[model samples]
Target: MATGDNLTTTAYIQHHLQNLTFGLHPENGWSFATSAEQATEMGFWAIHVDTMAWSIGLGILFLWVFRMAAKTATTGVPSGLQNFVEMMVEFVDNSVRETFHGKSKLIAPLSLTIFCWIFLMNLMDLVPVDFLPMLAQKIGALFGADPSHVYFKVVPTTDVNATLGMSLSVFALIIFYSIREKGFSGFVAELTLHPFNASNPFVQALLIPVNFLLEAVTLLAKPVSLALRLFGNLYAGELIFILIAMVGLWQLPLHFAWATFHILIITLQAFIFMMLTIVYLSMASEKH
Candidate 1:
C-alpha cells in the first residue's frame, strides 16, 4: 500500500494549494454554470466558507479579549492579559498620535481595530496549508461528496478580492473623513483651486480643471497602491510556499526554514498596510 502515488510529495502539495478558477476551462471544458457553481463543483466554496468563519471567529475572540480587559479595570496593578492588551494599546495609540492630529476617540480605536484584524488575518499564514483543507475535504466527504474533489484555500490574505475589498473600505473612509473635515465646497475647492491658485478669473477657470484632474488621479492612486502592495506580498509569499512544498521530502528542512522566514514577511506586510492606512487618513485630513 505504501507506493509512490501515496507519498505526499511536493507536486501534491502544489496541486492542493492551487486556486480553483472560473475562467479558461481545462481540457474537460466548463463543468459548472455560475462562478459559484464552479466553486461548488470543485469544492472551492468550502474554502471561502471556512475562511469567512475563521476570520470572523478570530475577530470576535479579540473583541471579547478587549471587552474583558476593559471591564476588569485596575489602577494598582496589571497582570497577564491586562498587561499584554495595555502594551498593544499603547503602541497603537503612539502610532495614531504621531501620524494623526485628529480626534483620538475615533482615529485611535480605528487604528487599533485595523492592526488587530489584519494581524489575525495574516496569522492564518502560519497554519499548515493542508490542515484546514484536509478537514474541509473530510467534512465534504461525510456529506456524500468525494474528498478528492474538494478544493479549498484557507489563507484570506492570499485572496486578491479580499485584500482589495479591505483597501477599498479604507479608501471610502478616507473620502468620508475628507468631506467631514473640509466640508463639501472646501474639499472641492482644495482639489480644484488651492494647489494652483490663480488671481485672474480666466486663469483660475483654466487652472481649476487641470488641478481637479491631477487631484482626482492622486486620490485614485492611493487605494490602488494600498491594495496592490498588500496583495503582492501575500500572494507572492503563498506562491513561494507552494513552490517550496513541491521540492519533495528531501526539502523538508528547507520548507521549514522558508516558513520561519515568511513569518517576518507576514508581520511586515500587515504593519505596512496599517501604516499606509494612517498616512492616507492623515492626508485626507489635510487642508490641501
Candidate 2:
C-alpha cells in the first residue's frame, strides 16, 4: 500500500529525472546506467539517443533548406526561402563584421552555423517535456521493452556535457585565433605585458608571474562561465516543467501558462550563448 505522504509530487518528479545507475544498490553502482534499470533488465539506449538524433536532424534540415535556397537564387527577385536565408545570412554577417575585424571568410559561416545549430537545440525546450520520451517509451515497448525504464531528456542544452562541449569548442577557437593572429611569442607577450608595462627590469620580473596567473585564470573562467550560464537556465526550465507536470493532470492550464513563459527563456539562452561566442571571438581577434 502506498501512502499519500510517500507519494509526494516533488519526490516523484525528482525520481523520474534521476539518472539510471547500474549495480546491486542504488547508491553504489559498477557503472552508470544510461536509463533507470537494474543490470538484469535490458536497457533502452534509444530513449536518450533521440536527443542527439533530433538535434543533428534539425541542423541538417536547416542546412539543406539554406543550400537549396542558395542553389535556386536569382538576382531579379528573391522570394520565400531565399529571402529568409538571406536575411539570416546577413544578420550573421553583420555580427561577424562587428565582432571580428580580420578576414572572416571561414568565421562568418562558422558563426552562422553556431547560431542556427544552438537556436534549434535550445528550441527543443519548447517541446512538452514528456512528449518525446513518452513516444519513445511506446516505441520501445513495441520492440519488447518495458515502458517504465525508457528515460530520455530532449533538451540537449540542458545537459551539462552538451553545454560544456560547446563552450570548450569556443575556447579552442579562441586559442586558435590567439595563436594565428599573434605568434607564440606574441601570445606570451599578451599574457605577460601590454596591460601593465614595467619600465625597470626588476619591476618587469615581479609582474611577469602575476600577469601570467591572471591571464591563465581569465582564460579558464571564460568557458566555465559560458557552460554554467546555459546549463543553469535550461536545467531550471526543465525542472520547472517536471514539477508542473507532477501537480496532477488537472494542472494543464498552469502547465500551459508556464510553458508559454519558458519560450522567452529558450530564445534568450540561445541568443546569449551566440552573443557570448561572438564576444569571445572578438576578444581573441584583439591584440590583447
Candidate 3:
C-alpha cells in the first residue's frame, strides 16, 4: 500500500496515469522504474511496457478466437461463436468492398484486424478503474517490488504512442500499395504533377516543387489525423472516467452513465479508423 504521505488526490490521479515504463535508465542501464522520477530519467528510449503487453495480448486473443471459429465452422449451420464471427467477417468485408476501389487480398483482413483489435483495446476502459492496478500492486509485493511504485495502465488505445504506432503501420501500407499499383517513376510523377498540370514543358517543370509540396502534405496528414483523432478521443474519455472516480460513492451512477454513452464513441471511432484507412489506400492506388 502507498504510504499516507503519498495519499493526496493529485498523487492518486498521476499514479494511475503513469505507465509501467522500462528502458535504459540514465545511470542504471536497462531497467524498470521504481518511481515516476526514475521513469522520466529514462528519456526517449523508454517503452511503455504495460501498453505494449496489453495491446499485443489483446491482438493475439482476437486472432486465436477467430482462428478457432474458422476451424470449427460448419457448412449447414453454425455454432454461436461461429455465427458471431461470420457476422463480423461479413460486416468487415462489406465495408472494405464499399470503400476500397482497387483490388488487394490484404484489405479485408487488415480492416477486420484494425476494427476488432481497436475495439478490444477500447473495451478495456470499461473495466473498473482501480481493480487491475490494485491486483498489479499485490502481485508486485509478492515479487519483492515496491507496491506503491508499481503501475499498470489497462487501456492501450488511450496511449498516444500505441495509436501512432498503428497509424504509422497503415501509412507504410499506403506507400507500399501506391508503389505496387504505380511504378516508382509513376509514383513520383503522381506526387509532382496532378491537381495542377500543364502541357508546356517549362510550365510543367516549374510546377513540380509546388505539386510535390501540396501532395506531400495531403499524404502525411492522413496518418497524423488517424493517430491524433483516436488518441485524443480515448484519452479524453479515460480522463473523464478518472475524474468521475474521484467522487467516491457518488461515482457509480456517473460511471455507469458515461460508460453507456461511451460505447457509441468507441464503436464509431473504430469504424472511422477502418474506413479512413481503406479510403486513404484507395486514393493512393488511383492513377489520377
Question: Which residue runs does candidate 2 get wrong by more than 4 Å?
Answer: 1-11, 15-48, 194-196
TM-score of each: 0.83, 0.83, 0.94
Q: Give lDDT tens digits, candidate 3, residues 1-288.
A: 232355788887888888999989989999888789998899899999999999999999999999999999999799999999999999999998988878899999999999999999999988977888888889989999988888888999988899999999999999998999898998998899977899998999998899999999988999999999999999889888888988878899999999999999899899999999999888888887
lDDT scores of the candidates, listed in order: 0.73, 0.74, 0.90
Q: Candidate 2: which pairs clash?
A: none
Q: Write the number of the candidate with greater lDDT, choosing between 1 and 3.
A: 3
Each candidate's clash count: 1, 0, 0
Better of 2 and 3 by TM-score: 3
Local error of candidate 3 at residue 176 (angstroms)? 0.5
Candidate 1: tens digits of C-alpha lDDT, residues 165-194: 788999998899899989988888878985
- Which candidate number would show the highest TM-score if scored against the true structure? 3
Instruction: Give the lDDT ranking, best first.
Output: 3, 2, 1
lDDT of 2 by residue, 95-140 (tens): 8788778875677887778778877887877777667777766886
lDDT, candidate 3, at 12: 79
Question: Considering summed lDDT, which 10 consecutive residues are worst modelled in model 2?
Answer: 39-48
